[model samples]
Target: MKNISWIGIYPALLTPFTENDEIDYPLFQINLDAQIEAGVDGIIIGGSLGEASTITAEEKREFLKYCVKTLEGKKTPVIINVAEQSTKVAIAMALEAEELGADGIMLLPPLKYKADDDEVVTYFKAVAAATKLPILIYNNPVDYGIRVTLAMFEELLPYANVQAVKESTRDLANITNMLNKFGDRFKILGGVDTISLESLMLGSHGLVAGLVDAFPRETVAMYKLVKAKRYDEAVAIYRWFMPLLELDIHPKLVQYIKLAATAEGIGSEHVRAPRLPLKGAERERVLKIINDAIANRVALPDYKNL
Candidate 1:
């Protein structure tokens, strides 16, 4: 299995699409470069923010290959999201990610089907058994309808490759509970952007951020500042970032974040069908928030030196 630190800002990268609705590799590379320059520790492709459901498996494989090839000697790990409905397919995707040089895989519970606790564990265990890549359980019961409870993780303990978790439960105490119960067993990453700082303050290993696609510098700065115990500096950035971060919690987050990224000149608003560009008052409203933040964007300090 590959080694992943599972620490610092790992952007849940937004998939930039062309007006033709295909994966925009050129634009994608641009955003990837920007992320790297911003000091992101890792990259998560084909995740919720990446509009995973609409992205074809072929596209995902190609994207993974592109990312691996692009980051060849950069020392940044690219972890693909495995959000399949079946254990077999999930395992297949995980294996493919490993084959394509992904450092790890973030596995979600069986998608769209509300599996019980035991079934969820079985699904994760089956995938873990099939792949050598490290697994980060994406525990977002709020949006996904299934939570990988601590007891469930206890069952998954035997799988040594199941190394980390993207904690999006919106329940801060679970952070403490995981630490109290299992101490350093699984690295915990803050998944929700709005509460990510709180999660870090509670001892999360890192952040899987959404807005980082557009605002990578600030996002990375916030993480670096927090880790350096510069709470005041981190909080100032987080305060100005609150409105934009809230965009990650919505149902139309893919579109919303894409708009923000577009405003930053890093991405476009193009998206796959069944999902469309934000329009009418919604577009204007979201743009106002993005514009306001840009207008008053905080001047980042020498976070890189921290």
Candidate 2:
């Protein structure tokens, strides 16, 4: 694993699959290499964008092992999401990720179960104790049913490794509240794509981006432009890319993003079984947006090949 800053474009990865229902390692390597080439700060594995629900536990372990080996010499860190619904499984996965040499872990509140504030806090504490790696609480309350409320975070304060949060609450006011209540206590990374620019402007340290899985160069450019305080330049790209970035919120996000990635030559559009590839009108509509973006594209000197 590389030296992870936890404050930059750390794209949630989209796993590629073979028609035989196994991981396409060659295609997966292509995606990983592309992120490294495009200068991403880190890469997150087994995320929602990676189709984690459909991917098996064994596949996740293999993916983590492969990433730790492939990224051995690079400076990019590998962080995996552990979304198990049970605390026991979550702790086991967290320990395995650390053992596999992952730099950090992104954890969601127990999936499919509505955990109360105390249960959520206890779950976090147990997993935090099981591993020494940095833990990024995936706090997307809208999509995940369970909210990591301020009161819950108050309890998580004791665990030093649980300082960062992938803030997807979509409430900018909450961002202000977090900063006000416990300034710098959490390294908030904007998890939603459309509001990425706003989050950065509101003092987010970085973006745990989705569209960047395919449009890495543009994503990095936006982040760099914002960091440079060149709001105009960043907004210009954000305006052009917002349509595709919004795709991250759709139901078929994995397929949509894989297409965008393949269009950019970074990933394959082969999603796992439970999810089928987009076809007919839906396919054309998404392709039109992706192709048009490619056609009337930004003349980024560094991204022309992409």
204-278: candidate 2 lDDT, tens digit per residue? 989999999888888888888888877888888898898899899898888999899889887777877778888
Alpha-carbon lDDT, every model: 0.93, 0.87
> What TM-score, computed on C-alpha atoms, does each candidate reach?
0.98, 0.95
Q: For residues 209-294, write the lDDT of model 1, one tens digit per residue.
A: 99999999999999999999999999999999999999999999999999999999999999999999999999999999999999
Error of 2 at 196 (Å): 0.6
RMSD of 1: 0.8
Candidate 2: C-alpha lDDT: 0.87
Off by over 4 Å in 1: none
What is the lDDT, from 0 to 100, of the residue 301 in candidate 1? 95
Angstrom error of the Cα, residue 15, model 2: value is 0.4
Q: Candidate 2 — which residues are off by over 4 angstroms? A: 1-3, 301-306
